[model samples]
Target chain A: MKKVLGVTLGILTAIGGFVDIGDLVTNALVGARFGLHLAWVVIVGVIGICLYAEMCGRVVAMSGRPVFDLIRERLGPRTGLLTLVASFLVTLLTLIAEIGGVALALELASGVHYLLWMPLAAFAVWLVIWRVKFSRLEQVFGLLGLLLVVFAVALFTLGPDWGQLLHQATRPHPIGHENWATYAYYGIALFGAAMTPYEVFFFSSGGVEEKWTRSDLVTARSNVFVGFPLGGLLSLAIMGGAAVLFLPAGIKVETLGQVTLPVAVALGKLGLAIVLIGVFAATFGAALETALSCGYTIAQYRGWQWGKFVRPREASRFHVVIIVCLVLAMLTLLTAVDPVQVTEYSVVFAAMALPLTYLPILIVANDPDYVGEEKNGPVRNAFGLVYLALLTVASAAAIPLMIITKGGQ
Target chain B: MPGESGRVLHAQLHLLDRQLIDQADGHLAGKVDDVELDLDADPPVVTALITGRERITARRIVDITTAVTVSVEDLDLDYYDDWVENHVIAKIPGARHAPE
Candidate 1:
C-alpha cells in the first residue's frame, strides 16, 4: 500500500509539472488557430522529452551529478559555458512567462488587472520556495493542478464528433484558411513546449534531490512512462476543447480567459471557477519549477550547493540566483509585454536550446562511468538517434520559422 | 573510485573537470582544475593540487590554458580527505540529503 501511494504521488507530480504557461498558452493558441492540425507535434514532443528525461534521471542516479555537471565534463569549459548561457537565458525567459502567467491567472480569478498582481504573485512563489518543504510543495500544487482535468470533462460535455478530430490530428496540416508556414510555426512551438529544457534539468536534479539510485530506476521509468503521456492527454484535451468551441466561432485564444472559455460554455460558472484554480496551480507550480531550475543549472555547473533540502543560508548562491531570476521576470512582465507572446517565443527558443543539453546527455548516457550497466540499449539509442536528427532540424529551423511567420502572425 | 579492481581509468576521463568535494563537511570546495605530481619516484607521487578559478568559473569566459601532467594513485572514498560521493548513499527517497 505504501509503495503504491509513493509511486502514485510521483506520477501525479510528473503529470502536473509537465504543463506550464508554455502548454497553457501555446496549446490553446494552436488549437484555436489551426484546430488539431498540429496535434501530432505534441506526441512527438512528449516522446522526445521522455527519452531525454529518462537518460538524465539515470545519469543523476548513477553519477550523483545532474545533467549540467556531466555537460561540463563532456563538452569542456568553453563549450559548457556556452551551453550554460544559452540554457540560462531560455530558462529565464520561461521563468518570466510563468510568473506572468500566474499573475494573469490571478487577474482572471480576482477581477483585478494582472499587472497589479505581478509583484504579489512573484512574492508568493518566492515565499513558498523559502518556507515550504520541497515534497509538500510538490504535493499541494500537483494535486490542485489536476483540476485542469476540467478541460477533459468539458470536452466530453460538448459532445464533439470524435472521428473528425482524429482525422484532423492524423492528417496534420493547416486547416481551412490557415497557411503552411503558420502551421509549421505552431508545430515547432508545440514541440518546444513539450520538450522544454527546464524539464530535463529539473527532473535530473530532482532525482538527485530525491536521492535516486540504481534501485529507483524502475520507479523513475514508470513515472515517465505513465505520467508524461497522461500529461500529453491533458494538453490534447485543452486543444480539443478549444477546437470544438473557439475554432468554429472564429475566436482565437489570445488570453488565458479564452483558454477557459470552453469550460465556461460547457459547464457554466462552477466549471469556470474550477478551471481558474487549475490555471493558477499549474502556472504557479511551473513558476517554482523554472525558478528552481535556474538555481539547479547554475549551481550544478559551478559546483555550488543547491536544493531546498538545506538551510537557505547554506546554499546562499543558489538562493540568490532564484531571487534575482524572480525579480528579473517580474520586471519583464511589468513592461506590459504580453505573457502569451513571451510564452510562444520561449517555447520556440526551448527548441533551439534542445541540442545544447540533449547532445551532452546522449553522449554521456553511452559512457560507462556515468550510467554504468544502465547505458542506453539498442532500442533506446535508436530512438535517441532519431531525436538527435529531429532536434537538430527543429533547432536550426525554429528561428527562421519564427521570423518567417512573424511569430505565427 | 569504485569497487572494481585491475581497471584502467583515463586521467582526462575520470579526474579532470569532475566536481571536487571536501569529505569533512561535504561542502563543495571546487572542481579539479589541475593537479601536480613528483616525477622522482617510481610510478611518481602527487605533491600538490593546483586550484585555478578560470576553468571552473561559470560567471566568466574560460581562460585558455595548456594541460598539466600529474602522476598519482587514485584512492577510494576511504583514503582521501576530499572525495566525490554519489547521492545514492542516502537511501531514503526525498530525504533532503546532499543538496548539490
Candidate 2:
C-alpha cells in the first residue's frame, strides 16, 4: 500500500509539474487559431521529452552527476562553454517568462495588474527556494497544480463533436483562412513548449537533489513514462476546450484570462476559481524550476556545490546565482513587456537551443564511463538519433519560421 | 593519483574538464579546467589538475577515474565562493540554516 501511494504521488507531481506558461499559452492560442490541427506536434514533443528525460535520469542515477556536468566533460571546454552561455541565456529567458506568468495569474485572480504582482511573485519564488525543503516544495505545488484538470472536465461538459475534433487532429493542416507558413510556425512553437530544454536540466538536477541511485531507475522511468504522457493529455484537453469554445467564435487567446474562459463558460464561477488557482500553482511551480535550473546549469558547469540539500551558506555561489536571476527577471517584468509575448519567444528560442542541450546528454548517456553496463541499447539509440535529426531541423528552422511568419502574426 | 605510475591514459579524453570532487566532505570543489603535464616523460603525464582558470596545483588528488577525487584541507580554488558566502549570502537572514 505504501509503495503504491509513493508511486502515485510521483506520477501526480509529474503531471502537475509538466505544464507552464508556455504550454498554457501556446496550446490555447494554437487551439483557438488552428483548432486541433497542430495537436500532433504536442504528441511528438511528449515522446521526445520522455525519451531524453529517461536518459538524463539514468545518467544521474548511475554516475551521480547532473546533465551539465556531463555536457562539459563530453563537449570539452571551448564548445561546452559556448553551449553553457547559450543554454544559460535561454533558461534565463524562460525564468523571466515564468515570473511574468505568475504575476499574470496573480492579476487574473486579484484584478490588481500584473506589474504590481511581479516583484511579490518573484520574491515568493526565491523565498521558497531558500527556505523550503526540496521534496516539500515540489509536493505542495505539484498537488495544487492538479486543479488544471478542470480543463479536461470542462471539455467534456461542453459536449463538442468528437468526430470533427478527431478529423482536425488527423488532418494536421491550417484551419480557417490561416496559411501553411503560420500553421507550421505555430506547430513548432507547440513542439517547443512541450519539450523545453529547461525541463531536462531541472529533472536531472532534481534527481541528484533527491539522491537517486541505480536502484531508483525504475521509479524514474515510471515518472517519465506515466507522468509526462498524462501531462500531455492535460495539454491536449486545454487545446480541445479552446477549439470547442473559441474556434467557432473566432476568439484568439491573447491573454491568460482567455485560456481560462472555456472552463468558466462550461463550469461557471466555481470552476473559474479552481482554474485560477491551478494556473497560479502551475506557473509558480515552473518559476521555481526555471530559477533553480539557471543556478544548476551554471553551478554544474563551474563545479560549484549546488542543490537545496545544502545550506545556503554552503552552496553560496549557487544561491547567489538564483538571487541574481530572480532580480533580473523581476526587473525585466517591471518593464511592462507582455508576459504572453515573452512566453512565445522563450519557447521558440528553447526549440533553437534544444540540440545544444540534448546532443550532449545523448552522447554522455552512451559513454560506458558514465553509465557503465547501463549504456544505451540499440533501440534507445535509434529513437535518440531520429529525434536528434528532427530536433536539428526544428532548431535550424525556428528562427526562419518566426521571421517568415512575423512571429506568427 | 591512485592509478599505477606507469598506467597509460589520454590527457584530453580522461582528464580535461572532468569534475573534481573533494572526497573529505563529498562536495564538488571545481573542474579540471586545464592540466599541468610533464613533457620530459616519454609520452608526457599530467602532474596537477588546474581549476578555476588559475594555476593552483591539485596536489591532494586521491583518485582519477571518471571524476577526479581530491582530499584538500581548504578548497582555495573557490575564492569567489568564499567572498560571496561571507559578504553576500551569510548576510541574509536564515542563510546558515538548511531548509526544513
Candidate 3:
C-alpha cells in the first residue's frame, strides 16, 4: 500500500511538472485560433515526451548517470560541446520565457507590470534551486500546481456541450478558412511545448538526485506514464475552455490573463483566483526546473558536482551557472520583448533541438553496456523508434513552419 | 608509476576519457583526461592517470603560450591538485555514509 501511494504521488508530480508556460499559452492560443484542430499535435507531443522521458529515467536509475552525462560520453568532446552550446542557448531561452511567465502570472494576480517583477522572479527561482531539496521542490510546487484544476472545474461549470467538444477534438479542422500552413505552424508549437527537452533533462537528473536505483524503475515508469498524461489533461482542459469560450467569441489568446479569462467567465472570481494560483505555481515550478536544468546540463556535461543536496559553496560552479542563466534570462525579459511571443518562439526552437537532446537518451537506454540486463524491451524500443521518427519530422519542420506562418501569424 | 599489473592495455579504449569511479562508495572521481606513458619499457605503457584540470588543459590544447596563457598558467595550482584524487575517491568528504 505504501509503495502504491508513493508511486501514485510520483505520477501526480510528473503530471504537474509537465505543464509549463509553453503548454498553457500554446494550447489555449491554438485552441482559440485553430479550434481543436491542433489537438492531435498535443497527443503526439505527449507520447514523444513520455517515451523519451521514460527511457532517460530508466537510464538514470540503472546507470546512476543523467542524460547529459551520457550525451558527453556518446557524442565525445567536440560534438558534445556543440550540443551543450545549442542546448544551453535553447534552455536559457526557455528559462527566460518561464521567468517572464511566472512574473506574468504574478502580474495577473497583483496588477503590476510583469517587467517590474522579472528580477525578483528570477532571484527567487535561483534561490529555490540553490537551497531547496529536490523532492521538496517538486512536491510543494507540483501539488500546488494542481490548482489548475480550475480549468477542469471551469469546463464543468461552463457546462459545454461535451458532444461538440468531443466531436471537434476527434474531427480536427482549421476554423473558418485558416490555411494549413498556419495550422501546421501551431501544430509544431504545441508539439514543441509538450516535448520540451528540459523536462527530460530535469526528470532524469532529478531521478539521479533522488537516488533512484534499478528497483526504483517502477517509480520512474509510474511518474512518466501517469503524471505526464494527466498533466497533458490540464493542457487539454485549458484548450477546451478556450475553444468553448474564446473561439465562439472570435478571440485569440495572446496574454496569460486571457488564457485564464474563460475560468473567470465561467466560474467567476473564485475560479479566477484559483486559476491565478495554479498559473503561479505551474510557471514558478517550471522556472525552477528549467533553471536547474541549465545548471544540470552544463555541470553534467563537464563532470562537475551539482545538485541542491550539496552545500551551495561546495557546488559553486553549478550554482554560478544557475545564477548566470537566471540573470541572463531576466535581462532578456527586461528588454520589454513580449513574454508570450518569447514563449512561442522558445517552444518552436525546442522543437528544433528535440532530436539533439532525446536521441542520445534513446541510444543510451538501449545500450546493454549502460543498462546491463535492463535495456529497453522490444516493444519499448519499437515505440521509442517510431516516436523518434515523429520527433525528427517535427524538428525538421519546426523552423520552416515558423518562417512560413510568420510565427503562426 | 606503472606497476607490473596496471599498465595501459589500450589507452583510448580502456583508460582515456573513461569515468573514474571510487571503488568503495562509487562516487565519481573524474574523467581520465590523459595518461602518462612510461618510456622505460620495450614499448611505452601508461604509468599514471592524469585527472586534474590544469594538467588536462595543458595536455589537450596545443598553443599554451597565448595572451590567455598567464591566467591559466598562474592561477593557484593548489585548487586543481586536490580536486581529482589519485587512484580512488573514497576519501572525499561526502562519499562515505549514505546521504541522509
Candidate maximizing DockQ: 2
Candidate 1 Cα lDDT to native = 0.80
Model 2 residue A368 CA deviation in Å: 1.2
- TM per candidate: 0.88, 0.98, 0.87
Tens digit of lDDT per residue, candidate 3, span A87-107? Answer: 888889888888888999889
Q: Model-by-model lDDT, in order? A: 0.80, 0.90, 0.77
Q: Residue A308 error for model 1, in Å?
A: 1.5
Give the Å error, residue A246, model 3.
1.4
lDDT of 2 by residue, A89-172 (tens): 888999998889888888988999899889999999999999999999988999899999999999999999999999999997
- Highest-scoring model, lDDT: 2
When 1 and 2 are scored with TM-score, the better candidate is 2
How much is B17 displaced in model 3, in angstroms?
Answer: 4.3
Q: Which is the winner by lDDT between candidate 1 and candidate 3?
A: 1
- How much is A93 displaced in model 3, in angstroms? 1.0
Pairs of colliding residues, candidate 2: none
